[model samples]
Target: MMPDRSDLSAIAALLREVAGSIVMPRFGHIGPADLRTKSGPLDPVTVADEAAERALTEGLRALFPDVAVIGEESVAADPALLGAVAGPAPVFVIDPIDGTQNYAAGLPLFGLMIALVEGNQTIAGLIHDPLRDDTMLATRGAGAFLLRGAAARAEFLPLRVAAPAPLAQMIASVSWQYMAADEKSRVLARLDAIGQTPNLRCAAATYRAMASGHMHATVSRRTLPWDHAAGTLIVEEAGGHVRRPDGEAWRPADIDGGLIAAADRDTWHRLRDALYG
Candidate 1:
């Protein structure tokens, strides 16, 4: 069954509490000992990430019985749990801090993400901006919108992607760090037509920019569930488009072959063919 307004509200409240308690308090005050490098030098996880994920996981499990909780930090400790997201149970995907590097660097661009994936589809997803205390939320079939302010007194702002524009006018976010040496040069060589290609280094914020129309598209070579699931649903629900470079629909469990998102289907295809074709 689809989540009703009350259910969605509960999820939003939980996000707010988690941010207020675990995230904001330790944002710029992370001790060096509490931080460690992950896949690369640029990737770092702090105490806040672990605390927030643990808080959310426990709270969510109590709030909704029987759903598997898959957190980025948890998966790091046990690689086998990643397979559970593709299993039969509903999975609550969590990214306590989507941009830990930026957060650790004292930048306020990081955000929180949650998505409920059942089977191969994302049903309800949300991206919460702790710095601004606002959240972008969407459910399949229902529209997407922004909730700004305290949970009880938040304002609802409808979100929509920018209308299709000429390719030369479109802006995009592409992280060069995720690309290989040969493919990186090949892809960068073909981006002359875009207005600008900025790398936010934060998927949560990158997708927010796309869903709210500030950016026309984003190219992601890495597709972790916590990174893409919530953002993908929000963008698509806001009338944007998403697909793999190979033109396959982006399922919840599909992580290979990278992902492309654009203001519309035509723009997505044009950009994909030019860069990946």
Candidate 2:
């Protein structure tokens, strides 16, 4: 089931509130003891990530008592929690700080991402940027929109993907670090030859950039639900396309394989063949 309009607004507000009370206050004030190495030294997790996730999880549970919540920190503590996404219960997936590395270094590129998953499909999605005080939201069958500011006078901008552009004129953002080391060079060499590729190190911001019509496409091998669920719905609602490089629909339950999204199918196919073939 999709999140109601009022629920989306409330969740968006909840994200901002959590960030204000739990995330922003501890941004540049973290100490060595508050940080830890996760997957590797380059992958870091902070107290803020945990705090934000905890607060959001609890807040969401209170709002929708029957829904299950799967957060990044929660998954780290128990990988089994991912099973909830495919279960009968509606699951809310959360990524508290998508660009933890950027956030750790005092950059404001990080944001919070949440998606409502019913079985295998994403029914509703939201990506919130506390730094900018705006949110990109989409519910199934409903158009995506950008809500600017949190005040009563907030502005709503209807979102649409940019007009289709040729491969040579495309501006794509790719996350190369997620690719296999041996194949990264060849793939990137070809990507650089065709378009201007930039890595913002944050999926939420990258998706926002695409849905906002500032980018043509994005390629990524990391396909975690919390990371891509909200993004897929937002871009699709904006009239863009998303699928695996081999041409399969993206579902919240699948966690492997690469994804390529573009403003049009023509661009998606061209970019997919050029980069993956």
Candidate 3:
């Protein structure tokens, strides 16, 4: 069943609470860490990730008994298992720790991402910065908002893409994915036109930067549903566009590792034209 606007709001509140409980206990306590790699050397996961994911999974099941969930940890065990909840039916996509690297490094930029995919498209999203207890939320057709603290007032905000800015003055964010030699050279060449290329290691932070208009745009060569889901909507809700290099529309069920997001429509087109040519 499709959740109404009120339902999404309630879910966001629950998600925020879950993230706070699981993540706050270990904040600023960088002692006796328990971290491990997932796919490669730099792809790290910690106890906090698992604990937070478990909490989210359990809470969602309790709240929406009929809904399906696909979590980062579960997908890691059997990547093929993701198909079980990828589309059509109501599904909850989660990245318990969107910026695992930042979290491991003791940075407060890390966050929790939760997105509800209804039939292939993301209809609602909520991102929580557990360290700061800040929440960015959005529902399709409805506006987005930022909520601070437990009892803070919700600020209703509209997302509108800015007009085209000069490419030389634009700020672009890209990930250092393990690209092949040819891909690396091509990406660098594309970025050369922009004068200065900025790279941020964490997706959630990068998305936040772009949404807040500090960064003009952001693109990632490698991303899963959880990586882009919540942030993509937040950016779009904050007046941005999220798409692919070939001008292809992004679908939530896509796990083939391509993600592009920009602060405004024009910036997105500029980057797309530059990179694809």
Which parts of model 3 are misplaced by more than 4 Å?
30-33, 149-153, 159-163
Which of 1 and 3 is the better model by lDDT? 1
**lDDT, model 2, position 200:** 91
Which whole-number lDDT from 0 to 100 does residue 274 have in model 2?
87
Sorted by lDDT (best first), the order is: 2, 1, 3
Taking all chains together, the TM-score of candidate 2 against the true structure is 0.96
Model 2 agreement with the true structure over 95-161: per-residue lDDT tens digits = 9998998888888898999999997889999999878878999998999999777657666689999
lDDT of 2 at 201: 89
Q: Write the per-residue lDDT of candidate 1 for residues 41-108, one digit (tens) a residue.
A: 87799999999999999988888887789899999899888887687668999999999989988888
Model 2, position 81: C-alpha lDDT score: 92
Query: Model 2, poorest ten-residue lDDT window?
Result: 147-156
Residue 112 Cα positional deviation in candidate 3, in Å, after optimal superposition: 0.2
For all candidates in order, the CA lDDT equals 0.87, 0.88, 0.75
Count of residue pairs whose backbone atoms collide, per candidate: 0, 0, 2
The C-alpha RMSD in Å for every predicted model, in order, reads 1.4, 1.4, 2.3
